[model samples]
Target: MADILTLETPRLRLRTWCDEDLAVLAAISADPEVMRHFPAPLDRDEAAAMLRRIRDHFAAHGFGLWALERKDEGQLIGFTGLGWTGFDAHFTPAVEIGWRLARDQWGQGFAREAALAALAAGFERLGFAEIASFTALSNRRSQRVMQAIGMHRDPADDFDHPKLAEGHPLRRHLLYRLRLDEWRERCP
Candidate 1:
C-alpha cells in the first residue's frame, strides 16, 4: 500500500508498519525482558501512541523506524531504524539507530541484519554524520549490537536520559556513536 516501504539486507527486510503489526508491537512492549530497559511497560494507549509517533516520523521525515519483517514468512517481527532522540544539553539533533526484535526472533541475527540496513539509510540517505544508540547499563545485548556495528561508547557524553525521572533505572545510560566517516573507513 505504501510502496511496500522496504529496506533490504542479505537476509531481512525493513518495511513500513502495517495495521497487522499492532498486536506484535503490543506483545513486544508487554514483554518483561523487552520492557526491562524501558521505564515501564506500555499499556495499550501508550503502545498506540508509540505507533503513531513512529508513523508520524516517517510522514514528516521521510524515514523512521521501518517495521522489520521476515522475508521468508512476511510476518511482522519488530522495528529497526533511526529516530530523533529529542534535544538536550548532552544530546541534540541526534539520529539514534535502534532495533527491537520479538522474543521469538532473538538469537537469529535479524536485529543485526535489519539494523545494518537502517545504518546504511542513515548515513547514505539521511546524511547523518554520526548515528548514535543508547541503552541502560543492564542491556548488554543491545550494547553488543552497538559494538558489532562499529560504534564505541563515549563516556564523556553520557548523561541521564531527560525523559526518565530521577530514580528511573534507565535514567543513567551509555551513549555509543558511529560516525559516517568511520563507517566508511571500516567498511571500505
Candidate 2:
C-alpha cells in the first residue's frame, strides 16, 4: 500500500483517511451529541459519502480533513485539518482549519493538539496566507478550540451560512481567522 500523508503532534497523528476509518467516523457522525452543532446526525450512507469526499479532497488538493488518531492508544478519534470552504460566501475560496472528535474524546485537548499541527502545515508547509474557521453561534466548544489555536473572531465577519435555510438555528455563524504573520508571531 502507498504510504499515507501524515502529520504528527505531541499527542496525536493527523493522517489521510483510510477505508478502515469509515465505521468509526460513522459512529461519530451519528452520535447526536457529536452532531449537535451540525444540522443533524448522519446515517451510515451519509457518513460514507463524507468519507469519499474527504478522500477525494486529499487526492485533489494534497490535504483535507485528515483522520485524527490518538498516539497513546492508536485509536481513531475523528478529524482535523484544512479544507477549501467550497461555498460562496464572503469567505469563499478560503481554506479553513477545522476538527471533530468523538463525544467521548471531548475535554482531552486532542482537538487543540491536532489543530495546532494542522495550522503549522497550512502556514509553514502549505504556504497559506491565512486560514479561517467558523461554527454555529452556539458551538462554544469548537469556538474555544479555534481560540486556543490563536484564531481571532471578528463579529462583523459573522455570517448566515447560505447552505442553511433562512432562520435555521445553525445558520448564523461566527468567523475566526489566523493570518500567517499572526501565527508566526504567536509561535516564534
Sequence-dependent TM-score of model 2: 0.97
lDDT, residue 149, candidate 2: 91
lDDT of each: 0.83, 0.91
Error of 2 at 61 (Å): 0.5
Give the per-residue lDDT digits (tens) of candidate 2, residues 14-124: 988778899999999999999999999999999999999998888888889999998889999999988899789987789998888999999989999999988988888
Candidate 2: segments with Cα more than 4 A from true spot: 1-4
**lDDT per residue (tens digit) for residues 1-188 in model 1:** 12225698877888878777888898888888888888788877787889999998888778888888888888888899888876584767788988888888998988877887888778877778998999988899999988888899978988888888899877888899999999889866
Off by over 4 Å in 1: 1-4
Q: TM-score, each model?
A: 0.93, 0.97
Kindly give the number of clashing pairs for every candidate: 0, 0
Residue 51, candidate 2: C-alpha displacement in angstroms:
0.4
